[model samples]
Target: MPLTAQQLQAWSRQEAAAAQQVTTATQASIWLTLWAAFTGWYSRPQVSDLAARSVRILQPARQQTGGLGAAYVREVLAGLDAVREKAPAINLPAARLGADLEQVYSRPAEAYRLTYALTEDTAAATTAAQERLFTLVRDDLTVARRDGEMLQMRASGVTHYRRIVHPELSATGVCGLCLAAADRLYSVAELLPIHDRCKCTVAPDSDTADEAVSIDLDQLYEDAGGTDGAALKRVRYQVNEHGELGPVLGVEGQKFQRQGDAPKGDPIARARRELAALEPVLDSLESRAAAGEDVAGPLAYQRDRVAKLRAITA
Candidate 1:
């Protein structure tokens, strides 16, 4: 039997609620570790040591989320009798977390160095360092766990997924970037591109789903009322390769610091570069669409990317 829109939405909420519990615990662990490090609890107090300690605190939380992720996907597949296979386990090696944490730790280290040189007060120096470390640690820890779950979900029987933007899940509400992506379906092979503190969860698409549920962006923009056409055009959804976290969602002008890239060129140049890379994909989609494949969603997305690229290059 095909699942109704309401049933799909209900499942999304249930999965999101379960994921939120783990997110809360992981964030709590980050805060507790940061508090202990800033205080005199750690005798050494090196930034490297702080990163190591934070990763250690988060290991159990990561494992829990991974397990939940596998179970969630397994249950979803089993419900549809899609496949009898088990969902793959998430393998977030400690070394990977440590490497990423080391980069985040650098911000606090630089803050402490600069502040101590200027202020000459140990208390002020430590406070500045703590303030810098707080956000980085929280965002990193949260995203890392989410990324691991996403990886597991992709390898599982989930072929397609849709974004669920529940404003109540986030205190700040949804951002325009996420709002722009709300109406589309994404393949599970793609990373659920996220910004820091993104509260959106994904609903797995059942082969027997009766309807594609999504937010109406046109109505949403109309309610806002002041954004002009140019402003609207700025909401280009493209994924950039992040140095630590693989593919991250960003708008047209946003630049990502790739792990081993030389200095990124100007925005137009980057757009051209991306367009060149996307050409083969667009060709493949066009071929598929012409053959009567139901590829309207993906084709529209690619066409939009090409249009945006041309606009930039112009």
Candidate 2:
């Protein structure tokens, strides 16, 4: 009962779609957390109380969606069992199941920081930050929900898996880097590389690398016009390792800031740079305040932050 590549592709598409549904469920939970944040739920509480409350609100989402994801993985494995029943049933550890929950839950706080740092207009900044927060939560949860399936695939005697690119499934079509890697076998030990709203799926393979289905690499070159072309070269070599997202597709002149890569400079120097950047914002706020505009709250917050930065730099 050997499975054909087309058969794998079909399964991958269906599973990828189902994964999106799971992601949608995760997003609903995230929206509630975001609403709580915007409504000042986290602002008025003690840190310890906030932590406890956050866990209460987020834990159910984690458990419910995690259970669903694990069940989905088991169902997928059961289907693959018809072809080869070598995989053993195993449960994902509880710690691993909710590993990313804290990070996802902290996004609103991160957005709060970003809202202040980005713009002078509080309303506009808040809107932008909230939008970014939703996107980040959605993307990160997409990966988190699939963690159980990936872990099970590796543990279930799967030697390798194929990356199926479903560009048609997402509005943001698959990038060339993914396209280059698609339809090819990767070791199950490797984490699947993904980007924002990626709809790719990995199909477990019991076969050797040599027996794995192959993809035409030259087709990318053909699509890029020729082998010597810059576009083709970038497609082949611009792949980068992202600390948070695993492998990432890169174009020319692109840079990545990995997790914990921030706060790089000395504290005083960083503070000085921040103060320098905030000068124009402060001026704008001051002019608006003098014009009888009702920007006192934002003005005060900015002035206080500037004072703190100056004290540090001094």
lDDT of 1 by residue, 1-314 (tens): 54455565556556667767776666556556564346332233565676676667766766765566556556555556646546575675453334665556556656664454344355776777766665554455446445655665677646787666554455444566777676677887776777766656666765433242443233334434544535554577777876655556788777777777676668888888777766676788789789998656446656777788889899
Question: What are the Cα lDDT values of the candidates?
Answer: 0.60, 0.56
* Candidate 1: Cα lDDT at 218: 38
Best by lDDT: 1
Off by over 4 Å in 2: 32-104, 116-118, 206-234, 237-277, 283-300, 308-314
Q: Give the alpha carbon lDDT tens digit for every residue of 1-314 in model 2.
A: 54554565556566667666755665555455534355342342542344345455544544444444455545555665654333334343443233454554455554654465447554666566556546655555455555655666665666676665665574534566666566456777676766666666666664421232343233334433443435433564245676554565565456666666765559898888788888788898899889999766556767878889888988
Q: How large is the C-alpha RMSD of every model relative to the true structure? A: 18.7, 5.5
Clash count per candidate: 0, 0
Give me the candidate number with maximum TM-score.
2
